[model samples]
Structures are given as structure tokens and as C-alpha cells.
Target: MRTKEAGAAMDSEFHVQCPYCGEELDIYLEPDVQGTLIQDCEVCCNPWKVEVWWDGDERSVAVSRGDGSE
Candidate 1:
């Protein structure tokens, strides 16, 4: 799993790069939630998958193209 860039302002927010267009995105995830969800890049408008989860005490996120490649 990839390490998450936590937003200093909120634990629920994370900074991630859009896999399609390389746009930087700030995404919000609910606490104790773990799953992959489809999200569109705010800048490029291309659809992708956002996988959010936690490993032990560390929050992690992985973005993947719509084709499912990371």
C-alpha cells in the first residue's frame, strides 16, 4: 500500500495525485472506512479509483487508473 499524505488541517483529508492527468487532489475519507471507490480528477475530469485504508496506525491511499493499474 502507498503511504498517505495527510492534510494538516484534518485527519480525514488526504493529498493524492490523480493517476490519469497527474493533478493534485485533496480527498476526504470517512474514519474506519476501507474500500476502493471511483473518483473523477477535479482538474482533468478523468475517472479513477481511490483506495483508502489503514495499516496499523498509518493511514494509506493508492490511486489507480480506470483500467486498474496503479
Candidate 2:
């Protein structure tokens, strides 16, 4: 994971493909934050519901369409 500093916050970035547009984009996740959020794709401008969490020593991320449904 690549670490970037923004202001006082440090973020770890990972690549995820947009389900709608199939475009890969970088997702910056804060180590202190863990939850689901809606984010827009930079390539297609489509919204995605992203879930981030830490499993033991590894981080896991799940992405889905932003329609508020599973």
C-alpha cells in the first residue's frame, strides 16, 4: 500500500475497478476509519458504495453499486 499525507491525515491507497465503467481508480483509506461510504468514480462519475475494514493484520475492502441495496 502507498501512503500519502493530506494535511494532518495519513491515507493508504489501493486500486479498485469501477463496476459500472470498469475503470481502475485509487481509493484512499484512513487507518483510523472503518465503515462503508459512497464515493464517486473519477472516470465514469458513477457512485460506488465502499466498505473498508481491517481483518487481523490485513485490510479488506468491498465495493458495490451505490443504489443503497445489497
Candidate 3:
């Protein structure tokens, strides 16, 4: 992931596959935002649970069903 300056917010981009739709998607999130959030799949309109975490300088992301189930 790379952080970009988006106006006053620092944005980070990640490529993730939609759990339900199985489509690749580019997701933008403010670097300051942490933890899990719900995002709708652009290709399938299904809700997705997006998890963001950082380990030191490394960034990580996980995606699953919006209902918090595998």
C-alpha cells in the first residue's frame, strides 16, 4: 500500500477481492482510519467487511463478508 495526499487527508490504496463477487477492487482509505469498516462491493453491491491494520511500517488488509462471518 502507498499513501497519497488527498487534500487534507492522507489516503492509502489497496487492491482487494470482493468476498461475494470475487472481483478485484481498488479501495481508498484515509491512513488515519484504523480497524474494521463496512464497504459495499462496487461490482456486486454486496456488503464487505474491510479490515485494516499496520505492523510497524508494513500495512495489511483483510476482506470478508460484511456480517463478520467467513
Candidate 4:
């Protein structure tokens, strides 16, 4: 039988602000690191397509409207 190990579960959070309402939000990204690209605002419910780029030592994140409309 498989047994669970201590500290094996994901335990990391990424905090970011909502693009529409500018509300701060914390999103858990331990298990879903790659899946954390796009996220919707909880307050305004706006769809934000996030892009994260890492250049060796530096990391950058950008958020923009999912739709083509400005």
C-alpha cells in the first residue's frame, strides 16, 4: 500500500493583484505551477491572461485581458 509522506503536499502561494479591480489575491501554485498562467479575479470576475517568463536568474509576470478588447 502507498503511504503519505510529510511535507509532500504542495505548500506555496503566489500573491498578485486583480487587473480590473486592483484587488490583491493569493493563489496556491505549488501543485499547479504551469497551470497558474491564467486566473480570474474573484472580486470583479475579470479574466486575466497571465504570462510568466523566466530569464535564467530573473522572473517576470504580466497580466492582461483575456479577450482582444482593450
Q: What local distance difference test score does each model get?
A: 0.76, 0.76, 0.81, 0.61
Q: What TM-score does each of the candidates earn?
A: 0.71, 0.73, 0.77, 0.55
Off by over 4 Å in 1: 1-9, 68-70
lDDT of 1 by residue, 1-70 (tens): 4345344225677889888887888888776667888878889888778787777776788888876555
lDDT of 1: 0.76
Candidate 4 per-residue lDDT, tens place, 39-60, comes to: 7777888898876654454344
Per-residue lDDT, model 4, residue 69, is: 62
- Cα error, residue 25 of model 3, in Å, equals 0.8
The sequence of per-residue lDDT tens digits that candidate 3 reaches over residues 1-70 is 5454443253378889999968998998876767999989999998998888987764678989997566
lDDT of 2 by residue, 6-54 (tens): 4325336767888888888888877666788898888887889988887
Scanning candidate 1 in windows of ten residues, the lowest lDDT window is 1-10
TM-score (C-alpha, index-matched) for candidate 3:
0.77
> For every candidate structure, what is the RMSD over all alpha carbons to the true structure, in angstroms?
7.5, 5.6, 5.1, 5.0
